[model samples]
Target: MIKKALAWLECGEIKRLDWYGHEGNPSQLLGDKQWPQRLLPLLITGKLQMRVPSIHTLGSYQNWLGYSGSNLAVQNPKLNISSIIKTKEPDFNELKFHLTGMAGDGNKGHIWLLRLMQELLNRENQTNKEITSNLRKVKLHFIGLEIDKSASLARELRYWGRAIMGENFDWTAHGNHQDTIRSMAKANIAVSCSKAETFSMASLEAMHLGNLLLRNRTGGWEEQLLDGINGFDLGETEQKPGKKEIELVHRLRNTLITPSKKLTAMSIAANKHSQIFQNIKYANWLLN
Candidate 1:
């Protein structure tokens, strides 16, 4: 697929390429190690005009490729009909989390489920004790009906159910985009554990619908998601080498410690930030 796309960049007729970057790290995230080497020829020849979604990705590319060129730019991320999702009143009693994405995407593996499972197992096998009791208030909703159909995900979910067998937390999968939107509207937080992304549409849409996001600091996550104001950025803490899942789970528990009032304020800020995407479509912002 990449070969086919790159072929178009130098297919005799095209003068220059405006390559939009959507992946966080091609080497690690998308598992493509040779692309940077392949791109070097284009970069050196001044034929590749690289554009990325977030400021973070721009910086990352510069540092990774050591290319301090003038052909790169930060194109603002946008959403598609994001305002269709209606907002609802806050729910303080339970922490409802929504996670949505395509199931089979290589970088989009649902690794968070493993961290959650380890956390539950450490809490006395969901015995309704102090630790487990508090965690039971956490409900995770995996939106997009296709998630329920993924065989790979099914294996993780089976282990997930067994690990938290006696816990009261709700784990559900919804079928349609409307249902996904409704879930996001109702959720207190939205999560993404993708290894790499320029600026995830799920995170943007969730924020637009007034849901606090808990995601990594890849791409321009810092600019888009402000810690304690819009959402929590886990880039600094979650990416350590050989980090255990229990530690990740502990970080998740810490996120839940933020006061409900504070979270409400964060949600409001997220919604406000998302207004840019609602007003400006991606094509208009990128082209003209």
Candidate 2:
């Protein structure tokens, strides 16, 4: 719809109100591809522009620059969404599955994680608690949906419950499901042990829900998580030489065994961080 709408509109001097400045992969939230290189010239000539929080500096450019020249930067770390109305928590009567991408894609291994989650469930008549103890209180339900169904990532997630978990895992491949966002926000904890994420909407949503985040230390998760506070970020041997991934995973797993005593404080921090991109405040900077 947006592509069609943009195609119909005349580009000459018309007011441009867009979230992304140029075409982005959509899989990642890093701003548009052309914006940085394109904007450099415009910025020089005084036609191109952007806004920033007083606290940010040009040095922050290192965060989002991919392995390319004229790389894009993500200065605006926080998102600005519309006001979030109070929502009642839905009864998690079943296991909730959020497979993010296609099975074969190297970058989209979160789909495989979802499959692993389902396989963990299907083993020999295990009760919900036996399969996933943390989620024992809630029923097990699986969901497969994304912004684009035709996307390879979306397709891999579609087959999650069918092939892996069998009939026990409920599958909803393509549909406009509004409940997903709200539910994600209400989850007890946001598990984003993904292989890669420059900036994760998943982690932010979990933060909004007052849920502890468990993620690796690469990418945006490292920037977001304040260790032993709201969440945990794992480390690599190179950074902390001779360390192991299993060790990091084990440490995080052990931490989750005990419910957080500082849950309230962490929740407050998460909520506060979420507000940075909640209102139109973020838009004004980019437009102005």
- TM-score winner among the candidates? 1
- Deviation in Å, model 1, residue 179 alpha carbon: 3.3
> Which of the numbered candidates is closest to the native, going by highest lDDT?
1
- For residues 207-230, write the lDDT of model 2, one tens digit per residue: 666655555543465456776677
Window of ten residues with lowest summed lDDT in model 2: 50-59
What is the TM-score of each predicted model, taking all chains together?
Answer: 0.71, 0.52
The TM-score of candidate 2 is 0.52
Tens digit of per-residue lDDT, candidate 1, span 1-288: 657667877685566666777766645653565767777778788777777788878887776666767666677665776335677766545667666765554355455544554454555454545555454256666555244445566456545644563353344464567766766777778776666677777788888888887777665576578776787655542432224444443444533455567667888898888887766555753353
- True-structure Cα RMSD, model 2: 8.2
Q: Tell me which residue pairs clash in candidate 1.
A: none
